[model samples]
Target chain A: MKYYNWGIIGLGEIATSFTNSFQQENSQITAVASRTLSKAVAFANEHDIPKAYGSFEALLADQAIDIVYIAVPNRQHIEHILKALAAGKHVLCEKAITMNSAELTQAMTLAEEKGLILAEAMTIFNMPLYQELRSQIDSNRFGKLKMIQAPFGSYKEPDPSNRFFNPDLAGGALLDIGTYAVSFARWFFTSQPKVIASVMQPFSTGVDEQSATILQNDVQEMATVSLSFQAKMPKQGVVAFEDAYIVINEYPRADEAKIFFNDGTVETIVSGDSTQALNYEITNMIKMIEGETSNRSLFLTKDVIDLLDQMQQNWTN
Target chain B: MKYYNWGIIGLGEIATSFTNSFQQENSQITAVASRTLSKAVAFANEHDIPKAYGSFEALLADQAIDIVYIAVPNRQHIEHILKALAAGKHVLCEKAITMNSAELTQAMTLAEEKGLILAEAMTIFNMPLYQELRSQIDSNRFGKLKMIQAPFGSYKEPDPSNRFFNPDLAGGALLDIGTYAVSFARWFFTSQPKVIASVMQPFSTGVDEQSATILQNDVQEMATVSLSFQAKMPKQGVVAFEDAYIVINEYPRADEAKIFFNDGTVETIVSGDSTQALNYEITNMIKMIEGETSNRSLFLTKDVIDLLDQMQQNWTN
Candidate 1:
């Protein structure tokens, strides 16, 4: 079997992006599977993959497929994650990883029991700019880490049948976009933070269309996160300090940040290319599987899922 | 007496900014006052004023003063406002117009009873661009108002004895910078919105150092306001709609906005001068006193204060 052997279990838009990104530097797409044989064959032919399977189980049974990239819809994450892990293949699923902490814990436990790797394909956990900023923060280059603001908004049509507002699809701003905002926040806080307060405006389908949440870490460093589905807000992230602040515009895939100091000097910091965001996630997943790095990003992802769970729980009242 | 005679009840930095701003167009400053006679006399000489008062009482007794601009500290706003209104002069008090809604209501009622005009020096209610934006919204220019964001932050030293953290002076982020943030949000909302959620970080002196509040209007339009006293946040405000959104940088004194449409068209809107933000407040106050404009700004100020009161009350619990 070739090193870094990979198979895709879904042929959606996200799956195409993943296949293209992973193939940019290395070609290890051993096979691809879709519910329909024609669709899988078409995708595999277009991507020049070695094989295509009509059933996910057939691809999982392939001895050459050591890892499975689960690109299915949100509602199918846990089932696919467990199936791939139980089939002795490492799993890297798209965000959000699961519906709640319970589901995530079950999957995590199964992966641990099987001695297999499992991670959420949250770009926030893999972005090189965040990793660079995290080290700068730890090095005390700026003063105390005090405040962070993460705002993400994407305009989606109000049609109730649309996937953005469809309740059966686990559709809402929270799972769709709030995961990134919360993950960005969780990565900055010193420790796990609690959801101090949360409020949401629900769509006609009883899903959160827009929401605001406040989080405070044990050290009193607070974070404010705002999300919306009907408006386009700038994806600006601010990490403020006592004597300076770091601002990253279009922060989700940002490779640059401007640091404004109280002493009237501004410094700009740059990291890896933003266009390679997906490739960065794939590279990091490979490193974790190869035992080259610790699974800290997975821990942060777990905390973020917990935060999303609590925020949703809060809205139920 | 001049048609628009004005007297200032404080000799602080804000009072100086007010003097400079009001003089840019027309010179109507009739007198100046300070508790110290020498300070008052120096201020009068520097500004070329006709009279100076050693005490606030002496300024209220000046028959030539038809209006009073109270620029005292936050804790002293109510006292000077009441004194100015009771002396039969129209009052324009610095924001955080009063300690609480009760105090503001008392002053508002007294002003109504005494037939004197009273208004807060909140530039948000008087800025021409906001008025222009409001009319545009009324004209259905941008499908529907969905979200508004107002964030303000000003860093101060962590000294507990400093006025920014002193409880005796009613010094806090809420009264100081939050007034601007909240006022910006309140001006855009269709109706009075309740504080759905609030969280704050207190300073060593027990005054709020930073805070976040979520508000939802009657039409389900949502707003997010964040404030800080120990960090500098961009005073950028966002007014988002269904198909387009307006962004104003340095929004507290903004005279321009950039409208971004979904179809990739960008339009710039400009009105008035930012340098004359305080002058706009002065001009609008004069218009209200002259029976040309209604006391709508004052009503907005009252609503903003009520929201601030509720946020503070939440912190105590």
Candidate 2:
């Protein structure tokens, strides 16, 4: 019956939202950090946290902090994760957890060596509705999983220097938004899937602005992940099966899904709250910290990173 | 304008639906032919048709029949088309018009030499709702078109003897139902598109049971078409643009569509009637016969057949 104290670094919009969950039960966000002392002080004051640090190292080095939540840019995740793990803190990094599988494997190895928990703040991995839906599928009513369609498209202004299209920031649609779609697909897959065919359209800065990919596994389960930055598409994730198909629109933190059965019937399933998305991630992370369960979602995160790796390789060649 | 005297060859289920359009103002379905004389007579008597033929050649030789609608299976389309065209009849053949581009090309050349009209009875080509939407795009208020997704999946019982999986019947999801999806994508495209990536899974009878394909044209318009016979997917056709996206559910013969704008506005567009889908085909064919308009949709049908050709080629290699 212990509440976990969290320390957040990289004071961006997402980090600000993460701190907003401090009032949730079983949560204590005690520390905040930024490179600028004034910015860190202002954020800590706004969130009413007890401590603020001018640098990430100072916060990570704090003895009272149990979890270090990294909200740094995609390019900076690996360094922050390694540094936090080295400073004896369990790390919960933002999505696109690492640039590639190699970096993630290195971080996972270090976390295991240090006997600390490591996980991604991917909403799909933590959403409770998906858990209930998965159990429904396991009950043999929905039948076998057959196909998946996960499309994430956002219309960003055509600015080359923005993080979305910038190469120096590890920017592209895949890392910034495609991660959610890929993770959504990987969650339902029985085994690791391989990218069989893919194509990409690059932006003015030579990064993936949009792409379409097809994936298949040993069990013949297929998925299509379509992503775009120059256009807007609904965050609708569909997992189609034998007897029924489930539709989860705005799926990153969706709390409701509609199951459409072949006999012309629909059942509504609701679980958890969309407002408590970050809180759920925190509570789940705390459970992993308590040795109640493991960070099993890392398997899906690793598979998603590998899939992204293959999607971008299509443009290089 | 003359209501062309129509003769139907191959009195199948689809042919029955075609004759049901006799009540339309511009339809004159006068004759029908079947391999069995009894079936032909039965169909003719049921539809109040004046003539019934024991064989396809007899129907083609009847000078009173100016237009012949070929409602045969996919494998038999080319033969019926070439024979009907040689008899100086304008031919309207069922979809998957020919097995491949070569067969269609041969039929097209003979029709041109004989000064006859040849078209495919693809509902997308004749659906009035799509025509209105295309004009909306051309008006530039909707902005530049960006992406399209045309998914059609139908759950047919897994009877290998049925046409959906029988190789002898030219059965497969792609040829049967996938044609509607591919043709839907081709309708709004600016030019011919090439298949960029494709993957297929065959049923037990070695026919394509399901597949996913990506296509891109010279104008950079991209589309994803997913088809499966083992699953039931709404025939939702999405045409995304910079300003708004139009969604046509049951798009094969859709009569209405919803336009979702980036500014959180939904506009419903209703153009044609769903019940008059077959009648629209006959009317459009009559327009082509009168030389008042060209069978311009044939261009889309041709491109769709070519795309399907490339899609199935993935399995052979």
Candidate 3:
């Protein structure tokens, strides 16, 4: 059995969630790092990690860490990923992979030169349930796909101090929740659609509080997506085909899904474990590090990056 | 008192909702019309309407019917409203007043020549809750107005036979629910903003199932909106200002609203009656007919029509 030692480069909420998930999976969190030594020490102690570093650079220097998970804010993703790649460590970076595709391209090039595995940590893209959904579509079970709608949002009391609504942190609904919806649209469609229309609400900090986007391909196939930080939502995505429809209950990172056929038959697929999707991404990264695969699926990562770039350019906040 | 007797041009579901709402108010339904006399007569008997006509033309021919409410499908709205105006009757048409603004301009010109009230029946625009929300923003109670997020959708089994998804009838989210969200954004901002981004999904009948939109004005204020028919959604809109937020529980004619101030004071304003917004429009029209007001609120009606027209032009459906 092959196992890779993992190091997390941030001690934020997401990073903690990933660490807890990894612990449940019997994966090793070899080290943890944060800007503050006390925070890093507390997290490391809480997670029973073997090492804690005072700074990101120190964590990158740890030779035993085979892979690094970059869970920093959006603006810092590229910088941290490039640093980890230069250090000869495999990298799994969070969504909105970089500030834009230009940065993504630069990181991809650097990773290729270093012969290091670099994957955008979009766990939903590799989920068994999503794969099954794609299989069903590929098999033409739903007939010709016509439309897709997904909305993910939540009401968070405005706190200027939170990274989510901070403009300097590249924070907003689009870069955050919208990225998930847009990525799903791009993944299923496999083409860049023109943004035919859009409406957005900018927060006081010049970041989007909520946004709705309408994208269409040359053939007029369309997808509508909504993301917000202004209301409570039951995360969902529905794909309507000519003969049937697929309803994803908890979309973007759905664990269970159902396909409703025109013939009145229902097919259900449930991902057995309720584990966070980060576990799957991290597990995949370890496999790649052990020479199990050539590189993270280029098509999926490119799709995410391209979609993010287009969305960021399309939206000012 | 110039009590202009009203003729309803369609006995559809929306027409029924409107009539039910009007029954609670002072408005009188003088006549009801449908293509089938049996259907019109049944509706008249059920609602206690005074007159039933077999055809729309018959209703128009009746010299006693002073005004006409065109509640037909979107594609027929232009034809019916134009004919009603041409028949020397004041017109209060449904939202998406016409297929496009060009038709609106033509109708407005005709109404002007005839010295009649040609108002788009946008109930939300006439609602007391919306007016209160506007007042809060105007008074800077919520500080500098920033963003508005609203979504309205429902999950209903898609039947190709239904008018909602039928492209031939100009049915889609944009013309249906999208019109409400889009119009609300424009109304709140009080300006026509350029569409910064958009995404849409087409239905089996070549109509939009869902649409997400983002818009930004020259002043840098933005509004985000989402509209769909593919999922069940809570009816709501959140208007976020710099220092406070107003939460509207039932949007598109909210029955009640809560305003939360930064100082921790929450004020709940109950909406007038459970009546649909159309009654408010009917009341306004009645007042206009009585010569209480010189002309229709052109700014409100024009802004709404212009917004819907611009959004439709970008339709991917």
Candidate 4:
């Protein structure tokens, strides 16, 4: 099997978590970059990464890195992903993919021109548990799918300096956690629902502290999602059907899930967390580079980016 | 002081709770009515009400009853309130005062013509706790209000037969619990905020099981609210100001609440709950009839009903 060397941008909490998960999965972290040299050096030392570079440019210039995972803030994802695509490296970008879909399309054009694989790191999509749930629904085990309800939120002190609460950082609950819930709804429902109405609370720093979104598709299929940074919430997803229901515990963040049927039958699907979804995308990119596939089919990273952009524009307008 | 003898329409859970509370507050439940004479007789006998009627029309036609509390389902609120208003009795309707706001307006106009008080039973507005919190915010104790977040949800089995999951009954989170959260936001902000965005999940019966809403005023003040019948949630409200936050426990429902300040100070405010907020309106109606006031102001029933109408239209559109 061919191995893909990875370069990571942005040495933040998520970056560290991805690095640790990648290492545990036996994936190579070939290079690491940060805005500051000292921080990069410290992260490299802690993670046993082969190379640490102070500048993104230097890391992009390196020929050994086969894939670059853009783990930076929302605004930076576009620039960094474009640069990585320009440098002939497959790119795995974080969620919200870009500040908007237009930026995402620009990056996609560049990636397409270079014959490079570009995917968004939406971890839940690649999990075996979700796949199994999808299969069950497709098989009509839960009868006709009716609704999906999910809430992903936490009670955290408001800190304007943090990227999660900084408007300039493209921060808000919708772009952060809401993406997961919305994506799950779209993925399960297999259609983009119209944003029917919304209510949001802006923090002191002008970022959404909590948001409630309601969407409905042409078939009248509806999904309700709540994302918050101001309260404690159950990190779960519920799929309600005509005959039965599927409950995903810690969905969008859980590797394993339980399925409940209308007949009082319960089945637990355990998909070991073998890799942080970022690393899985890296593996997929390696497969694509080795002539297996050309683009992402399940997530359609570009389409998701477009959908997010549309949602944000709708909210702002 | 002049006292108003009260008649209750629909002797269900809410009506029983209201009459029980009213009795404790020195209010008289002189008449009770339901579609079934047995139900009304049973309720009246249990509560020591002097009169039990088989139908709502009979109760409304009674000249001795000065006020009527319409505690029927959402679809029936308008009909019952209008009937009571047409009978020249003051009416205190339950939340989501009508199936939509148009019905509320018609009832309000009829009440005005009859010179009768037509108010909504939004007991939270009458609670001393909310009043105290409002006073603190008005006094600039928490600085300028920036955000408001509240999530109110409960987990229940999805049985199409249940009123909460039955579309024919106008069942949905938005019309039920969501209205409370929306009303709380409007009450706090005291302005009509645009519904920026919304997402919802419809139950098998075609009613919304869960809904998330975001609203923003022209000044950019925002509030996010989530309502669900699919999960358990903290029935509380959080008001984030420029310098501090006031956290209210079990807001929009409970009489007593704990307020948490940003500076780590905590205080508790307790208010009368004998009538589940129904007695407060009853007391106010008596005062109004006695020339103490010409109309209800504490709850601003008109504004709330209007807001609900606008929000429901926004969702449908």
DockQ of each: 0.71, 0.67, 0.16, 0.14
Candidate 4 on B53-157: residue-level lDDT in tens?
Answer: 999999988999988888888898887887788888988777778876678778878877988877777766666556666776678766555566766766668
TM-score of chain A of each: 0.97, 0.98, 0.91, 0.90
TM-score of chain A of 2: 0.98
- Quote each prediction's TM-score: 0.98, 0.98, 0.73, 0.71
Looking at model 4 chain A, report the run of 10 residues with the lowest lDDT sum.
A296-305
Q: Candidate 2 or 3, higher lDDT? A: 2
What TM-score results for chain B when candidate 4 is compared with the true chain B?
0.91
**What ranking emerges by TM-score with the best candidate at the front?**
2, 1, 3, 4
Cα lDDT tens digits for candidate 1, B41-101: 9999998988999999999999988899999888898999988989999999998899999
Best by TM-score: 2
DockQ, 0 to 1 scale, candidate 2: 0.67
lDDT of 2 by residue, A93-190 (tens): 99989999899999999999999899999988987998888788888888778888888778888899989999998888999898998999998888
Here the TM-score of candidate 1's chain B is 0.97
Determine which window of 10 residues in candidate 4 chain B has minimal summed lDDT: B296-305
lDDT of 2: 0.87
Q: How much is the lDDT of residue B13 in candidate 3?
A: 88
Candidate 3 C-alpha lDDT tens digits along A1-317: 55678899988989988887774243588999999999999999998988999999999999988889999888999889989999999898887788777888899899889988888787666666776777777897766655666666666678766878898888788778877787777667646676665566677888888766667777555676666676544466766665666677667667788876656688887873546677777766766766776563555667666665666576543
User: Per-residue lDDT of A225-274 in model 4, one digit per residue for the tens?
Assistant: 66677654556676666565566767776676666555567777776463
Give lDDT tens digits, candidate 1, residues A227-314.
9998888888888888888899988788999999878799999998888888888888888887888888878888999999989888
Q: After superposition, how far is residue B268 of candidate 2 from its true place, in Å?
A: 1.4
